[model samples]
Structure formats: structure tokens, C-alpha cells
Target: MSRARRLTASTTAYILIPILAAVSPLLVLPAITANHGASAWASVAIGQSIGTALATVVELGWGLNGPQRVARTSEKASLRWLTLSLQTKVIALIPASAVAAVAAAFLAPSDSLTSSLVACAMTASALTATWFFLGKGTPWLILATDGLPRLVCLALSAIFLVMGAPLMTYPVLGLLLPSALAPCLALYIAAKRAPLGTKLWWRARAVISALKLQSTALFARAASAVYIALPITLVSIASPSSVAAFAAGERLMRMGLAAVAVVPNAMQAWVGAPADRQSKWSRAKRAMAANAALGFISATIFGLAAPWAVTWVFSGVVTLDPISVWLFALAIFTICTSRGTGGIGLVALTRVRAIAVSAAAGACVGIPAILLGSAWGGVPGAVAGEILAELTVLSVQVVAIRRRLAAS
Candidate 1:
């Protein structure tokens, strides 16, 4: 394939994977709400949100670290690094999954079984070498290994929803099963491609140390969880109906964000490649501009269409306040713009510490916003808080990028 064609295929695949993942849940939510109502839908959302946190834990820093390492490592060392990363993730998964399971049992006792299942699936999915494929700029491999199972599971979830099965089953099958299967599929494909360095598992601890050597990205991700999952956690405690509505809006916002992310994803190599500071800054600025434009466009569309979209999707069984929908959309836009300008740009510049500081600033803002917002106004307040948090983070990042580029 021509280089251009290859890039197109890779970007297309990256975009499709997240869309496919969202489609299953999006399609099922209407049914879930229609049959079981908002409360039940809320349960599933809470389960998935907790699962997301656990997945982040099992991922450690690999999602950020592995891709860069893969880009720089030689073919001979690639297998070793892959093996090492997987082992470290597995080591982390045991404890993290255990904690998630226990937390599920205690906090969501009504659906603990399904919550635990989803957690396990997330942990398994975390083991998949997605970063390797991303770094190699071969997104099609991810589509096959990750996206295909997601589709299969989506079909199954729809079938179960039609059969009037429990709401929890939808996420377990549609979300969790595919995730659990991804690592196995990745391994099968890797085995066919070349010999994997399985023997490196013994050096897992050292590998983990290497992974943590530059863990600013990990800290950033950890800190961002305040805005990412804390709201759902709080809403789950405040009101089940609100959780359902928030989840729906948040889901759509993420779909839009994922759609907007394709360009940035495709530009990672160019941005991260070894280059003079001026050249890197110029490319980064252009990429950030494109990303922010995409975000604005997505937010506008989301705000305009969200009411009709929500009503149609859930059969009017669940509806969020228009303000909440708008806030959620704004949050998505700010997140996309911040990540593009700050997250990806800093990684490319190797100014990862700035990323951590930016995330910390967001977290400091988010914790209070989420807590007070949920306490004050329920879902809308929580979302409004998130909006503030993301904007704060973005401001810090944009300033950091400017100073770093100017200093260099």
C-alpha cells in the first residue's frame, strides 16, 4: 500500500474501534430503558464506570508508555518489551481486580456478580497489546482483534435485550466479553507474526520499573479520574435515574470525542518523532488547532441534536435536562482540545511533567466541582463542575506548551 493509503486505513481503523464499542451500548440503552427503566440503566452505567476505573488500574502506564517505546524499540527488542509490559500489567491486575471485585460486592451488592464480571473483562482487555499496534501504526490489527469481538458481543447483547434478560447481562456480554477476548486474540495474531519473548516474564518487576521511569502520563491519567468517573460514582449514590441520563449523554459525548480523535491519533507519529523544537512546536500547534476545531464542531452538533437524539434513542424513557446535555458536550470539547494541545503535544516534546501538572490542576478543580455540584444540583451541577475542571486543565496545558516551546 502507498504510505497515504496505509495512513488512511490505520486512522479509519482507530476511529471505527471506539465507534463500534459505543454502538453496542448505545443500541442496548434504548431497550434497557424501555424495559427496565432509568434505574436499571443506571446500574449498568455505574458498573461500567467502576469497570473503567479498574481497567485504568490494570493498564498501569502502558497505554501511554508502551506506544512510545514500541515506536523507538528495534524489532528484536519489541517482543521483549511486549512481554515485559504484559507481565507487569498482569501483576497489577491481580490486586486491582481483586479490589474492584470486593468494592463491587460491598458498594453495588445488587449487581455485584455482573460488576465483577465486567471488572475481570476489563482487566483481561488491558492485557491486549493495543499500544504496540498503535505504535506500529497498524490499527487494522486492533480492529480485527478488538473490534470484531465487540461486534459479536454487540449482536449478543441486542439478542439478550430482545429476550428481556436482566440489564446487567448486556454490559457483561456486550462490553466485558469482547474485552476479555481481546488479549487472547492479540496473542494469537502475534504468535502468527513472529516468536514472542515469553521468557521475559521473569523480569516483570524490572520491566514495571522501566515502565514507571517516566510516569507523568500515568499520574495525569490517575488524576483525571476525578472528572472521568467521580461524577458517575456520586450520581450512582444520589439518584439512579440521573445516572442513566448522565451515562447516556456522556456516552454520546465520548462517541463524538472519539470521532474527533482520529486526526490526532494519525498525527501521533509526526508529533512524537525526533525533531527540532521549532518544527515540533509548529506541527503540534497545527494539530492542536485542528483538534480544537473538531471539538467545537462536535460540541455544537451534540448540543443541537442531543434532545432529539436522547428521546429517540431511549424511546423517551430516559431524558436528561438540556443543561446537563450541554454541559456534558462542553466537557467533551474541552477534554479533546486539552488532550490535543497539552497531552499529545507534551508527550511529543518529552515534557511529560507539564502534563502531570496540568492534570493535577484539573483534579484540584474537579474534586470540589464534582462533590459540590452533585450535592447542590444533582447531574447538571456535576457536569457543570466537570466543565470547569476541563477548562482549567486546558488553560494550564496551553500555557505550559507555550512556555516550553518558547524556552526551547
Candidate 2:
């Protein structure tokens, strides 16, 4: 196949995997909301948020740097690194799961089972093989190892929910099962690919060293969590109704951004490919252009459709304020831009510190903004705060790219 055709196929696969995964929840959502109203949705949202936030903790910086490293390394080296990362992540996952459980309990104490299971399921998402597949430029592996399992489980969740199964079954089937399996499958595939490196997997003390080595990416992801992953959790604390509405809007935003995510999903490896400085810089520019355009188009569509989309999707279990909808829409644009200019650019160039500092600056601005905004104006205010943080992230990244990639 031609290179352009191959990239198009890869990007399509990446886009469809997440969109299908995100949409699968809708099967249970309307039923859950129709039967119970927004409370269940609130807990589910909190669980997803906390789970996603702590997923970064469990991921231990691999999410930020893994694909780029995998792109530029040999199969044996990639397999060794994968094994070592899995070792460290397993250790991290234990505590991260505990934290997610505790956080879920605290946030949605009213719905302990739902919150805890969903949170744990989401937490388990750290083990996804998608990044490994992405780096290796094998979208088919992603579909097999990560996407299909999750889709099967989520589809089952919808059926089970209708069959009057236990509520906790949703996360168990939809999330946790695939979360546990993907890495193991990836490991088997990696071992098969690099049979000679089968014995090079890391053990106890190496896990510790990997944790220390991961601290830089850890800080960056944590900083980003303030704006990206924690908003629904925050709103759940402040207002039960608000979390549902905000989460609904945010969920749609995520689904839309999945399409946007295709750019980085495909181009990260391309941008980070073994190449001369100019060639890498040129690829990065093209990726950034594509990313920004997609973001803009997505933001506009989301801004217009969200107010009504939430009602239809959730069966009126919750509804967002127009201001909140627009804020989320604006954030979609900024986040897409940042991922291109900052996420793709910085990681490709190995500027982890720049990414960290930019995220920290965003968190510094976002935390207070979310707190105060929620206090003053409610959900819309919080959404506005998130948008500000997104802008801060985009600005810093743009500046960094100009200095780094431009010079390159």
C-alpha cells in the first residue's frame, strides 16, 4: 500500500475505535438515566473522571513518551521497554486503583457500587495496548488487542443492563475486562515479534527505578489532570445535577475529540520517526495544521449541537446550560490545537520538561478558575475555567514549538 493510503487507514481505525468505545456507553446510559435519573449518571461520570485521572498515575508517563520511543526503537528494544513499563505500571496500578476507589467513594458516596466499579474499570484503562500499537504503526493490533475487547464488553453491558443484570456488571464487562486483557495480549504479540528479547523483562527493583525515571512525565500528566480529567469529579462534589450536565457535555466533547485525536494518534509516530531535523519538523507542521483545522470544525459543530444532544443522549437525566456548552465547545478547539502544537510537537522533540511546565502553568490557572467559577456561576463558570486552562496550555505549547521546532 502507498504510504498516504496506509496513514489514512491507520487514522480511520484509530478514530473509529474510540468513537465506538465512547458510544457504547449510550446503550446503558439512557436506560440508567430513565430508570434512576441523574444520580447514577453523576456517579458514573465521577468514576470515569477519577479513573481517567488516576490512569495517568498508573500509566507512569508511558502515555506521554511511549509511542515516540517505540517509533524510533528496534523490536527487541521496544519489547524490553514494554516489559519494563508493564512491571512499573503493575506496581503503580495497585495504589492507583486504591486511590481511585477511595476517590470514587468520596465523590459519589451515594452510589458506592457504581462509582467504585466504574472508577476501577476506568483506572484499569492504563493498561491499554493502543499506544504500543500506535507506535508500531499497526492499527490492526490496536483493533484486536484493545478495541475489540472493549467493544465486546461494552456491547454486552448494554445487553446485560436490559436483561436486569446487576448494575456493577456494566463496568465489569464494558471496561475492566478489556483493560486487563489488552496489555497481556500486547505482551504476547511483542514477545512473538521479538522472541530473542523474551527473557529481558524487568523485575522488582527495576520497577522502582522505572518509577523514579517516570516522575517527569508523571508531573506533566498530573498537571493536565487538573483541567482535563478532574472537572467532572469536581462538579460532582459541588452539585449533583451539575456533574451530570457537565459530564454529558464533556462526554460529547470527548467523542468529538476522538475524531480529532486521530491526527496525533497517527502522526505521533510519523513526526517522531527516525529522520533528520528538517524532515521531523516538516511532518510536525503538517500534523499541526491538520489538528488545528479538525479542532476548529469540531468545536463549531459541538457548540451548536451540544445543548440539544445532551438531552437526547441522556433521556433528559441532565441538561447543560448554553454557556457551559459553548465553553466546552471552545475547549475542544484549544485542546486539539494544544495536542498538535504541544503534545505532538513536544513529545516528538523530547521536550518533556516544556510539556510539564506548560501543564503546570495551566493547572495553576485552572484550579482556582474552576473553584471560583463553580462558586460564582456554577457549571458554566467551571467550563469557562477549563477553557482558560486549555488556552493557557495552547499558548505555552505554541510558544515552545516556535522556539524549538522553528529553530530545528
Candidate 3:
């Protein structure tokens, strides 16, 4: 197949996976939010927030570098690499999930068990085959192994919730099961397909070497996730009621982030392919432009429709302040753009270290803003912090892109 045609097909297929299957969690949320009390709802959000952030830590930044690494290797080599990545992530997961559970329990003391379970489940998603499939240019693996499980579980979770199942059922069926299962399934496939020798995947030397090499990406992706995810957790520290109001908006924004990821993700293989400097820059320009248009649309729709969406989804149990919603919407726009500039742009050019520096710069600005803002002005203030962080990452990336051009 021609390169352009292949990319177009791959992009369309990737986009469809999210549209058809991966959006299930969003569809199930109304049932969860309407049935649960506001505190329980907020507590669940806290777990997801902390869990997602720690999951990134467990992933060890492999998602940032794995696709490109695999794109350049043989199928057997790629499988072996995935095994190495998984072992390191497993080591990280032990510590990360523990921290998430502790923080989730402290924040949601009223609903500690469910909250901690949610946190642990989301953390376990570090094992997903997302990066491996993307590198192989096979979006179907995502649907078959990862998306389908999450979709089925989400449906079951919704039904169980409507029938008055305990709150823990959602996290278990909807999150924990799928999150851990996908990687196990991936590893099983790897074991069957790859001519992997008898070397132990759990060896300390291999895990430590992988960790050292990927440390920059680990720190970078983790730092960036802080601004994107942890705001609700931070808000919970101030007022549980405020968290409900903020959680709806945050959930909407997060779901939007998930939906829009197909763009940069689909483009990753294309951008990260071996190319001349100028051609690489051109690919990134097209990616950033496409993401900008999508970001604008996402922001406009989110800002205009969020008030009603939250009202209906929460069954009027949670009402949002407009200022907070719009700010979060703006953060959504910046984040989408940054995903192009930073997620694809920096990583594609083999500028992984630059991404780490930008992420650190963003976290330095974002975390404190969230910490102080949530305590001071509530959700709106916290969202403003996220916006600042996203913009900082974008600015640093644009500068890097420009420098790449000049040097070329």
C-alpha cells in the first residue's frame, strides 16, 4: 500500500475504535452518577484521578517511546521489548498502586474501600497493550484485547448499578478487570507468537536498565498527567461538595481528551517514521493543525453544552459554576493542542528529553496552582492552573519545533 493511503486507513480505523467501543465509560457514567450519592460520586472520581496518574507512573513512559521503538524493529524484537516494558511497569505498579490507595482512602474516608479499589484498578491499566498495538499499526488489537473488555465490563457495571449493586462493582467490572487483563492477554499472545527464549522477564538487571533508559519519559509523562488528571483529587481536599460540581466538568473534559487522542495517536507512527528533518517537521505541522481544529471544536462544544450535560448526567445532583466549566474547557483546548505539539511533535523528533523538561516545567507551574487554587478559589481556580500548565508545555514544544527547523 502507498504510504499516504496506509496512514489514512490507519487513522480512520483508530478513530473508529474510540467512537465505537472506547467511549463506553462515558456512556455508563450517568448511571453511576445518578445512582450514587454526591460524596460517593466525588469519592469515585478521586480514585480514578489518583489511579490514572499513578498508572502513568507504572507505565514508565513506555507509551511515549514504545511505539517508535517497535516501529523500527522485527515483530519478535517488539514482543520481547513489550515483555521488558511490562516487567518494569509491574515493579513500578506495586509501589504506585499502594500510594494511590493510601491517598484515595485519605481523601474519601467516607467511601474508602470503593475509592481505593477504583484507584487501584485504574492504576493497573498501566498493563494495557495500547502502545504495542499502535507501534504495530494494528488498531484492532486494541479493540480485541483492551477496548472490548472495558466495553463489556462497563455495560455490566451499568446494569449492576441500576439494579443496586454495590459501588465497588463498577470499579471491579468496569476498570480493574479490564485494566489488568489486557496486558496479561497481550503477554499470552506474545508468548505464543514470539520466539522468545527462556530468559526471565522478571530479572532485576533488565528491569533496572529499562528504567534507567526510560526515566526521562517516565518523569515527563507523569508530570504532564499531574495537570491533566489530579485536579479533582486536589479539589476534594477542600470541599467534597465542590468536588461534585467540579467532577462533572472534569469528567467531560477527560472523556474529550480520550476521544481526541486518536488524532495524535494515529499520527504517531507516521510522524515517528524514519524521515528527513524537513519532512518530519511537515508531518508535525499537519498534526498540530489538525489537532488545533479539533481542539477548538471540542472546547466550543464543551463550554456551551457542559452545563446541561452535567445537569442531566448527575440528575441535577451536581451543578457546575460556568466559570469553572469554561476554564476547564479552555484547559481542554490547550491540552489537545499540546498533545499534538508535545505528545507527537516532541516525541516524533526523538526529543524525549525535551518533553521531560517541558513536563517538569508544566508541573512546576500546574501542581502548585492546583494546590493553592483549589484551596483558594475552588474548582475554577484549580482549572485555571491546568490551563496555565498546558500552555506552558505547548510553548516549550513550539520553541523546540522552531529550533529543530533552524538547525535542519
Top candidate on TM-score is 2
The best candidate by lDDT is 3
Off by over 4 Å in 1: 2-8, 194-201, 238-241, 274-278
Worst 10 residues of 3 by lDDT: 192-201
TM-score of each: 0.90, 0.94, 0.93
Q: Which candidate order results from sorting by TM-score in descending order? A: 2, 3, 1
Q: Judged by TM-score relative to the true structure, which candidate is superior, 1 or 2?
A: 2
Tens-digit per-residue lDDT, 91-146, candidate 2: 88898898998889888846787889899989889887677778888877888888
lDDT of candidate 1 over 71-105, digit per residue (tens): 65555466666666667677777887777666554
Error of 3 at 93 (Å): 0.7
C-alpha lDDT (0 to 100) for residue 32 of candidate 3: 77
Q: Rank all candidate structures by their lDDT, best first, as comma-separated numbers.
A: 3, 2, 1
lDDT of 2: 0.81
| Winner on lDDT (1 vs 2) | 2
In candidate 2, position 276 carries an lDDT of: 80
TM-score of 1: 0.90
Q: All predictions: root-mean-square deviation over Cα?
A: 2.6, 2.1, 2.5
Better of 2 and 3 by TM-score: 2
**Model 3 lDDT on a 0 to 1 scale:** 0.82
Better of 2 and 3 by lDDT: 3
lDDT at residue 178 of model 3 (Cα atoms): 87
